[model samples]
Structures are given as structure tokens and as C-alpha cells.
Target chain A: MPPKSTKSNQSTGVTSPSGYLLTCDPPMKQFIINLNDKKSADKKFILEDLDATHLLIKGDVRDEITRKVDEWMDENVFSTIERVGENLDTS
Target chain B: MHQNWEQKISSYFSCSQVQNVLVMPAPSKRKRAGDASSTASKVGRSSADSSASSAANTATQAASELTKIDPQEELLSTSKSLFEYLERLPPGTLRSIYNLPPPGGATVAAAVLRSSSLTDIARQCALRLVACGGKFKVGSIVEKWIQRHGQRDALLALRRLESMGILEPLGLANRPGQGNDDIDDEANDSEKRAKLMAKIACLTPEFKGAMKLHLSTMSSSPWPTIAREQIEEFKKSGGGAKSDGGEKESRDPPAPYELELYTQSSWDSVLHFLVGSDEAGKDKGGVEEPPEVMIQFLTRIGLMQEDPDYNGADRSRAPLVITSKGYEFMLRDTNAQVWQFVLQYLNSLAHHNMKDAIRMEALSFLICLGSCRVGEGYFNSVLQSKSARILMKDLARFGLLFVCRVAGKKAFYPTRVAVNLVASNEKEGSRQTDAIGQSVAATRSLEESLSAPVPSRSHLAVVVQTNFQVVAYTTSKLHISTLALFCDVESYRRLPNVIFFHITRDSIRSAFRLGVKADQILRFLHVHAHPMLRNGDHQLVPSNVTDQILLWDRERRRVVMDEVWAHQCRDSSEFAAVGQYASDLDALAWGNAHTNKLYVHFGKSEMVYAYIRKWRTKHYNS
Candidate 1:
């Protein structure tokens, strides 16, 4: 699961930061395609680069491509955050 | 009404996840915003934009020179704005909003409003998403919401998205709602503002997680001044192996890697990460490459040669894949070694903007920096706030710090090599004298370490004083030749890592010409000189000698090349290719552009040699 935020604030015309959104990775594009396949059940959507891999979302069961892909792309392309963290409290 | 709306807005969007989602503006609109922001890099925007009624276009020339140099001033001011959004973003919705659809669809307005305005009616929308996670048409999602409720409700819903890290974060001293908004009089100190600005100066990028992932995947390094902590860990772990830097991770109990040679695949990953980024496909979705690759690489070709039970590899057992020793070494201080390589690699690629491929490396880099003991008094909360994961990863991937594993976590140990990556590392520079004194003391200790030796025994000062008619210290041949390069040699021989030489006018001139100005060289000598010269007259190296050296260097030209790897191609790019990928064993070579540095590390010695010698008859001298 993605790490949850603590406090929330008021509205401003803020937009998602592009640098954070499209971090520019080859696997990100493919990860989205693989994420959308509902029937594949491979749930394993992998983003690989260098000698490291950031995440592997299990999306093998879905066959329809777009939503699954969008969902995976939502988390993977924009971040490489893993489960382990500092100052993180998981109760 | 505006205040009430703002309050209602805050209340509606108080959920962190909703705040996170609202942070992202609609995708199409942001693309335009990105372009407007890019111009900020070129032009100097006034700092008054926060309260200003309209955007000012104040970029001119001539007397506006200082303004031009202060180019990123706008970026600086906006840093606060961005940070708040990320901080305020409601948890789950933050990432969702950032992932807005790429245009086109029914319910576009609803999806826009619902997702964007999540904070205001987040539960309602989340209920909608739970109601229609897969079936809702995005554009229609917005239209449907407005149709159900009225435009007032829709506008409020839309306003919800505004709370997420959407609008570029302005440089507010604190998160919008975190600080006291009523600081009207007493606390209005410029000093406090300066502290706030300093805290801001040290603030990590709002998208620190992405930045780390970006650097890690892209294989970039941190700036030179900020040494990757991983490297420091390596040094501590290597030399201080007897003692723990702090704590060691328990993931893999310390074990020795028993390998004879590195398999081509594992070796490449290690080298590539070190050289900059790990290879494509090999990183395995790791922050970069797994530590296993480092052990495998080192075991295969390094210090393991001394292992008594080493049987290279059982070509018959597993073929020459990876030896056990290789695995152990990598696990030993793998994070640090990787950091050292990345820092050097990033230093090499300093000229390029981060590419996506090496982000994992950068992430690993930052993890190593942040890995250091946390909540310790080493860096205050303010400095931590400023850099955190963002600068750390970027700096580490580029090999700014020597990173190592500590307390089951990655830790950073900085090195002095990368010069500009320093993020106020010393903590308090408020007292200039203290800062200078700290530096001087550090230098003194460093010089002493070099002189406190065994065997061949030669001090750099003795070597410099040779031409000044003094018997010098030092037995290292490498040092002798290096000294001879600029100082006149009274005596020396290039036998190996040892030698002896006297500093002379010609060499002094050369040294001065090569950037070791007379004063600096003299200072170096004074600091490291035989303890006897501490109180001696100013005739340390002799002003006459220094003058003559400066005179000699007058006509000499010192060339510096800023070299970097331009592109990577299969070494066999010369071969005709219909459609064949080079097998893992194929020898890979790189194309390089050495900008102004005069030396290149030799393939065989792994030592930097004058490029002129390596290039032979190449196109031209740098």
C-alpha cells in the first residue's frame, strides 16, 4: 500500500508536479500496459531500471487494459516508494 | 465570505489524501503551467508574485545583471508552495489525482471535479469510486456530480482538488495550516524569516520520493560537495571494519563472499551502477541493483584473490556465474560501494539533466544518505526538512557521499571529493571563524594522517622543499612523479607508487600554471611541513623561489577538460545488424566527451593518466 499522509490542508490551484508525475522511465510505459490486462491475472506489474526494481503490483487477474494500466501507472511511474520506511508508523 | 469559503475549503479538504489529490491540477492545464514554469529558469521573476495582483514581466538586461544571475529566484519562492501541497494532500487521493486521465472521455468534468475536489467531498467521491472504480467514464464523472448537486456544490467539489499539491507551492515558511497565521507583530523578525528561509533553503524537494526514484532509476549522482553517505560507510566499514559506524543491518548476516570471478551479468550491473546507473533489466526493480551484484562483482575479480579456499568457480558446478565470495562482499557494504560508483558516475554526468534510466541509482543514493542515524543531533530538523530524500538521492547517485549500511539501514559518510554538493554539511556556519577553524583543523589532521606513516616515510612538504635546497620526505614513486610534474625535481624515479623529488622553479611554475597557485602550494607546504618549520621565518619556501616559479608559469597554459560519456552503444556497433541483440558476453564500450579535464582513468591501471598519453594521435589536444 502507498504510504498514507497525516495532516491535510486547504485548497489552492495546485496541480500535481510533472517532475514527480512523469519521472521518465521506459518501464513506466510498459508497466501501464501490463497493468490493464484484467485477464492476465499476473498482477505482477514490474518497473525495471539499472539493477534495481521499484515495485511489482499484482494485476495479472485483470484482462481489460486501460484501468489496470492506469491504476499501476498511477503508483509506479510517479514513485518508487516501497513498503519499508523511516518515521513510518503502521498500526 | 472569502474567509468563510477558505475555512469551508480547509474543512472540506482537510483529509490528507484529498489534499494530496488536489495538489495536482488537471493534466491539460498543468502541461501549460509546466511551460510557464520552465521560463522561470530563463527569466528572473520578482519575489512579489505571492501578493501581487498580476504576474510581472521584469526580465531586462544591463543594470538587471544581478537579477539575471538570480535566475532561479522564482523557483526558490515557489518551493514553499509545492511543499505545502504535498504535505496537505489527503493520503489515498494524492497519487490518484496526480494520475489524472490523459484527456478525452465522458463525465470528464465530474472525474475532474470529483477527483480534483476530493478533499471537499472526498468520502462522497471515494464512495463514488467504490461505486464505480471501473465503470465510470472520467469526464462524465464531473458532469454527473454537478447534475446531482448544483453548480455551487460542484464548484466546492472542484475547489477540493485545489488543496492537493496542485497549485505550485509558494514559498510559505510552513505548511499552509501548520504555522500560526496570526504572526502579526512580535515574531515578525527578519532573523526568524532568515531562519525560515534557511529552513526553506534546506528543504527537500516537495516530490522527494519521486526525486529519489528518479535519480535511482536514472543513475545520476549527487553534487560533488555533498559526499554520498554510502561511500563514507564503505570507508568506515572497510578501514573501521573492526568497529561499527553505528549499527549494521540484519537482513543478511555478515558472511564472506567466496568467489573467483564475476559473471558478466553481475559484474556489469555493479560496474554500471558504479560508473553511474545500473544496466537496464538488471536493476530488477531494486532501488538500483541488488547488493548481491556488488559481492558477485568483487568476488569475481577483486581482493578475494587471497582467499585460501578460493576455487575461482566450478565451471562444471554452476559455470562461471557468481561465486559465493562475490555474494558476500557485495552484501558486506554493498550500499556504500554502489554509492561511491554512482557519485563518481553522476559527477561524470554532471552536465546532463537526469534521464529516467538511472533514477533507481539516485534513489539508492538518497536512501543511503537518509540511512544515517535518524533523529540524531547531527543535522537539525530544519536542515533535514530542506534536503531529506530529494537532495540525498540525487547527490548519492552521483557519488557525492560514501554510503554504507548502518543499523539495518543505509547510512551516508561524506567524502571531500565532490566539492559543491555540500548542503551546509557542517551544520552551523553562522560563525565564519568557527567554520574556517573547523576546516583548518580538519586539514591539519588530514595532513598528519598522511605523514604519520610506516616504511618509505615521505611527507609532501619535504618533497616540495627539495628544490628549495632541503632534503625531502616521501618514498612513494607516484607521489614523486606527481611532484615532478610541476616542481623542479632535485631527484626522483618512477619505479611505482614510491619515489623522491625536489621542488624546482620549472615544476613550481607548472604547479602554479595548473591551478596550484604559489600561495596555495606554499600554504600546503606550511601545513604539512616538518614540525620544525611551524615557527620558522616567512622564508618557508622562499618568496624569491615562489616569484621565480610564478614568472615561469606566466606563459604556460593549463587546460581542463569537462569530460563525460555521451552515449552508449554495443562495442560492435560497427557490425551490420538486421535484428540481433548482443548477448550478455558482448564487450561494451562507451563514447566519451572529455570537456576540459586533462586526465583519464586508464582501463588497465584504473588510475588517471594525462589524456595526451592515452589519446596518442587523436584529433586534437583539449
Candidate 2:
């Protein structure tokens, strides 16, 4: 079993700051997705359908998606700091 | 008159106009052309030749005297001295100077300055050169502009210039002679040209103000400036930077840490899929349909293999497994990992005959995404470009971006992977590596990450005990799956959060079969070993277990499994002929002359088979 994220880490409510993780399993929102291509017309996809591995998030998930990307950037910076520290130690 | 000429020369060759001077060939080359005109004068009738020769002799003496003047000192003291000397030459001599290789420096400088894609570091390096002193060593320029940028990055930038033919390393002249006159002459000419180029690069001031202005524009405003009114409208509509709680904050939005974390998982899942330990059923209840486009892309790159049993028509039923290529890819750092995958993707597209422009647009889009800020909606604006939109859709398949389409309106957000690529391109430099430059400031963190190798331990939550027992503190399925490669998971505990595993000889051999090296496994353990176990030195894991694991892995080397296709011929002569053909292709793996049989590597067997079939048909027909 994977270790459980703490209550704070477990994004529970959509409105909660910590709960706003894109990876968090949020409630399914009914949204109409119109494929930008010529082939597909307006169709329905749940928020879950826009999972990260095969993401197709459309409408209203803008804040959620932005929040997710921001988190990724922060992690990148954090890892960078860690790497720099390790290099310093080794040198 | 000499003093007045010197002042005119000095004023013209001021530091501010150094760019023009640098781009322009040295006064020495211009003097040589003047020498050419003097030769032309000497080529007339006897009396005329005699007078012309004497006149030319005096001119030669004057030119020689000018040459004796220390060029560096003259240029440094009075910028106009060199230009003044050039001015003294007849207009006919100017053509030869013009005929010389058009100043390579100014064009490169202009390109560097005007380039929207040039990284801040590269731009700064260019700016510094344009503002450099007339007399300076190559080492000094490198020290002043490049060293602090990062040693690897500096080398990459220099290499980039060398590849572009804008700068040539001084060492090329020192290489042993090719012994061919033409080659030697070319080398000599290039050496002279490079020296002149270096001088020009050192003193150029032509683009200094322009570069400074460009840098200031980059610093003051980025892409947002292009669509400034749109941004104002966005802010007016309360769609600007969001606060931590998804509210419109009075302050700028906090960095989107969660999105980055999501990006990490998204990328990790793709990696997990490659290694066969994806946390599918255990976490997500059931394995969702594998991302088909992503799988197809990986298959095309030969990183993942589709099930042999599945036909091309059945998309969902095609089971995919990680190839040996994928196994090696898992061990690389994220930048290298992403690079190899993207490179392979591009190569595969090229192989399939995709137009160069489309491939280039795909590449530029990736770099642009990397340069853009994490939370910005700039990705959507870039999608307005058709080729970029197509590329973004493919990028979403790679988990580099998440596309949102609502009622035919599409917006895309670049993931951390996409952003990392921007840093990768700039840090790596050179077209061979792929060049992608963004505004300098936006890429500072990305640059640091790209230039420095990230420690794998930072993500590890494992501990290897002296007794060969392994305990991991995290729930990341990826970690557990990786551990399962060389350790037997003895138990999974809940309360304090730990998974216990025992390293065994069999498990070690199993990992070796999967193309995992002894050192790789040891490094993994060493990186994951608990803080308490790390103790003074770098040897975190116990020496006994590490050595035993390596020995176990090595033991598998005794018998090699070579996959080959055996072919038998009717006669020894035929067998020998076919075998020779196979050997020529380097496909012949083994042969038994006694049995008139030969074996070829599976990968090359088809070609050998075709040749054999053709020879057999021709012989029988004849």
C-alpha cells in the first residue's frame, strides 16, 4: 500500500488551498468538450477523463491546471536547490 | 596632418563603434590590398615600371613602418589609428578589403541580439563581447562573460559558436599537418581569419547599445508585452495571477507548486509504464486504458514494444512492454531522459517523412513552453499558430502539457517537463543538441536544474539494513516497483508507514536480466539507504551486500542468450557464399561449416534472407 498523504496533503475540498492539487481526485464535473479538430464535435468528458497521463481537460479546470503547473515549477526549483547543495557538498 | 588623421581615426573607431570595426577586416588586411595595388603599379613598361617600383618601394617601406607600430597598443590607446591607416589607402584597395570574408562577427552579433529565442546567458555573453576592450585575451572574455554562467554551459556556448563558424578554437592550427598543400593552405587561412575574428569580437561596439536595449526590453517585459492589452483585459476580468486559495489576491500569485507536483506524477506514471510497475490496480482500482497515443509514440521510438500477438487494427488490445531501450532510459536524469525521448520522437517523425518545417515548429513550441512562466496562459496564445497547436496536442500525449478544449476553444498549459526542455536546449547549446533560448530571467531556475545533476536520493525514501533487509518509508508505487527489481518485498506495514523487503541472490539475477547493472542497483541502494546508515563516507549500503549483489549480477554473464536465425544451405559452397554476405553486413552471429548452416542476428536476418532468396532464384533460373 502507498503511504497515505496527511489530511492537509489529502486535497479534500475543491476550495481548499491544499486540496486544489491537479493530481487529487476531484468530484466529476459535467463539461462539454468540443474537439478543436474537424473530426470531433461537442462531447461530454468528466474531470477524471482529463487524467494527467492522457489529459484532455477542458473549461473550468483552468485554475486547477494552473495550480498543478505552479506546483511542478516549485518542485523543479526545490530539486534544483537540492542538486546545487549536493554538488557543493561533493566539491 | 598625421595628428589630425589620427584624431579622425580615433573618433571613428570609438568603443561605441567597435562592432563595425570588429565586423570590418583589420587594417592589416586592407594594407595587404594596398600592397596588391603597388604590385599592379610595378607591372607596366620599363621606365614606368622603374618609377612605379621605386614609388612602390617607398609605399612598402611606409606600410612596413605601419606594421611595426604595435597594433594592440595603437588600437587600445587611440581606436582611430587602425581606421586612419585604412583611410590612407587608395579607394581601389577598399575592394579587396570588401572582398575578404564579409564580417562574420556583426551578423552573428545582430542575430544574437535580435533573436527572440536566445537565452539570457547567451545574450549576455554576446553583449559583453560587443562591449569588450580592443586588446584582450580569449581567456579574459571567457572569464568575464562565461565562467560564472556555468562551466558546462560556457563550453556549450563556445562550442555553439565554433559549430556556427562564427568562432574557431585556436588549437585547430596546432594540429599535425594533413601534408596536403590545399588543406594546409586552408588551415593557414582559417587561422589568420580566426585571429582577425578574435580581434574583431574583442573590440566590437556596433551592437553594444542595441544589445543593451534588447536586454533591457527582455528584462522589463517578456512575451506579456506583445499582448499587453490582453493581459490588462485579463486582469480587469479577474483572470490574472491567483492567490493560494484560488482567489484573486491583492499580491502576485504564489508559485504553482501543486501543478509542478502533478507534472511530476504525470511524468513518473509514463516512466512507470515503461518499467512495468505502474501503480494501476493497487491505487486506481483498475488499470485505466493505457494512453494510446503516448504508447504509440513510445513504440515508434523503440522504447516500448507492442505485443507480438496483437494486430495493428486492435488498438486497445495491443499490450505494450518496455524494451531494453526503455530500461536504460529509466536510469537517466530527467533532462537526459526527456531529451532522448524527444529526440527519438523527432527522429522517428523525420524517418516517416514529416516536413522539416512541421518538425521545427514542434521543436520551437517545446522551447517556448519551457521559457514561459508556469502559471501563465501564454500557452493558449501560442496555440493560435497552427503548427504549434498540432505540436502541443502531441506534447500533451507526452505529459508535457495539458490541453483544455471547451466548445471548440482550446487552451494549453505547459507541464514541468515542457519547461525543463527550454532549459535543456539553452544549457546544452549548439544545433546538434538543439538550441532553445527564452528570456533570461524566466529560465534561471530551469537553467540551474539543467546545468546541475539532480540527486536521485532526494526522491528516495528507502533504507537498506546491514542484514540485507530493505525498508522504505514512502507510498510512492514507483519506488516500491523499483525496489521489487532486486529485493523480495517481505511485508507492507501501515502505522509508521514502511514496506520491508529482503535482498536475495535470485532477485539480483532477475534485475540483471532486465538490463539493470550491478553499479546501477548499488547506486540505487546507496542513494536510498537511510540517513543513519549513510555515516561518514559515500558508502551508504553495507559493503558485503553490495559486493554480493554485484557478484550475483556478474554470475549471469557465464551463459549469453543470443537470439539468432539459423539458415541451412544445400551445398557448402552456397553456405560459404551466403555466410560471407552475412559477415559483410556484420549480421553473421555464428556458423557451423560441417552442417552447411549459418546464423544471423535477428535484427539483420531479414536483409540476409532477402539476399539469399534472390541468389537462390537467380541460380535456379540460370
Calculate each model's fnat, 2 decimals: 0.00, 0.00
Residue A27, model 1, lDDT? 58
Q: lDDT of each model, Cα atoms only? A: 0.31, 0.45
Tens digit of lDDT per residue, candidate 2, span B57-108?
A: 4422332343344443233222111222222322223222222221212222
What C-alpha lDDT, on a 0 to 100 scale, does residue B472 get in candidate 2?
A: 74
Residue B576's lDDT within candidate 2 is: 83
Output per-candidate TM-scores for chain A, rounded to 2 decimals.
0.20, 0.26
Count steric clashes of candidate 2. Answer: 23
What are the chain B TM-scores of all models?
Answer: 0.28, 0.47
TM-score of 1: 0.26
Native-to-model Cα distance after best TM-score fit, residue B324 in candidate 1, in Å = 43
